[model samples]
Target: MATQAPVKTISPEEYLAQEELATERHEYIKGEVRLMSGGTPKHNDLSGNLFVAFKLALKKQPYKVYHVDQRLWIPSQQIFTYPDVMVASKPLVMQEGRKDTILNACLVAEVLSPSTKNYDRSEKFQYYRSISGFQEYLLIEQEQIFVEHYVKVEAKKWSLTEYTEIEDVIKLESIDCEIALADVYEDIEQ
Candidate 1:
């Protein structure tokens, strides 16, 4: 029988350093690094639409919006992830000397794709909840006009609201930003 090599577990610092030099992005969870898969065209459109909506709504405000390129650090769970869309109202918290990784995000949004839908709804979201400042989570669907909004009601407690119609408006109580389903699914053919 042939013996296989053991998988290596790397520290967050090492993962970050290596990630900076790599061409693709990855998510670091509990010392394990996994490459992020690509999103579909409809996924991109939904994510882009939401990002634009938040950008315009939070204009001239203290909130800063970031897309998938930005890394989010969840200290409690030792996780490093890239949310589809993130909004930080308070002063951004960086990882050590780097400005690309933020520790605090008021709202995090994920556009659900078939490949990552399960992880996004379960494990990934479980990690995101560890962030002290995380207040809202939006799970947007690519195939239909559906959105599952989870708002942090109190410590460790979250409330979920679902919207299924294009005319529905998602009220993001955390940042006081409202997202219209029509706008989010605009130009999306899937």
Candidate 2:
């Protein structure tokens, strides 16, 4: 008979503190820790293009654009996530002697990969919707032409719109900015 290895269970706070100290990135899901995978060329290109567009449009504005390195802490769920692109309208929450929590984000974009597609569309989307300041969420596909835009409608409702073609313009009503599909997929060998 073969012996099975023992399992380890950790609390969200422990997971977060450990992840913070490590050099690599990880996602916390209901106290479970999952290692994040690397993005492909297409994913990197799309994220870069979107970041550039947001930077240009929000230049000198009150909002600040944060790229992949920045981590967002979701207090309700006790999770830390690194969005591909995030825009914060106000200063984030900071402890007296600790780092700040990205609590003022208005818009967050996640470029979908094969491994994270379902999780991003479901679990992560649900978590993001719980945030009070989150107004817009964009999920861009890596292999195909798919972009799902979800805008907060009322207090607890969200309106979703999908764009599939290169000619379509993704309208971000929260930020008052519009981006063409071609610009998002710019130099990638589609």
Candidate 3:
């Protein structure tokens, strides 16, 4: 019998570089790399609507908004994730001469998919809270009127609020802006 070749696990740096070189997006967690799935029609519509709303609200302000193409790096976890929408107040960090590591993001939003809902609501929410400069995290659901907002109160505490109606507005205290539930779900089929 022929001996099998040993498999190799790529380091975070290698994974990051490879992702940068590739045409498609890939997320790195610890030493594992996984290709990200494309968004559904509903997901895409929701994200586009939210992006427009956020852009309109934050225009002429100091904040900059980024959509899905951007990636955020969590050094603590050695992870790189692409938030559906992100608002950064300060300049982002660069790696491999690319500005992919977003720092000073005051608000991060994720349009929840069935596959990623639990992770986004629980694990990813916890990880985002670990960032010292992160002020708010938003999770929007597609199938229902579910919206979760996590606002950091201080170094050790955070407030949890959930909105499940189209009439509700998500108030982002850090940015002095409010997002209507209807605006977020606009154009989304469900």
| Model 1 per-residue lDDT tens digits across residues 72-139 | 88888999999999998668888888878898898999999888999999998998888888899999
The parts of candidate 3 lying over 4 Å away from their true place are 1-8, 93-97
The residue pairs found clashing in candidate 1 are: none
Q: Taking the tens digit of each residue's C-alpha lDDT, what string does model 3 give over 1-190?
A: 9998865668977987798689988878777787888899889888888899999998888889999988887777777888899998845544446555775567899998888888888888777776667899888888988888888888878898999988999899999999999899876665
User: How far off is residue 40 in model 2, in Å?
Assistant: 1.0
> TM-score per candidate, in order?
0.95, 0.88, 0.89
lDDT of 2 by residue, 105-177 (tens): 7899999998888988998988988788889999998777789999999998889999999889999988888
Each model's C-alpha lDDT? Answer: 0.90, 0.84, 0.83
- Candidate whose lDDT is highest: 1
- Segments in model 2 whose C-alpha atoms lie over 4 Å from true places: 1-7, 11-13, 95-97
Candidates ranked, most accurate by lDDT first: 1, 2, 3
Cα misplacement distance, residue 24 of candidate 1 (Å): 0.5
Ranking by TM-score: 1, 3, 2
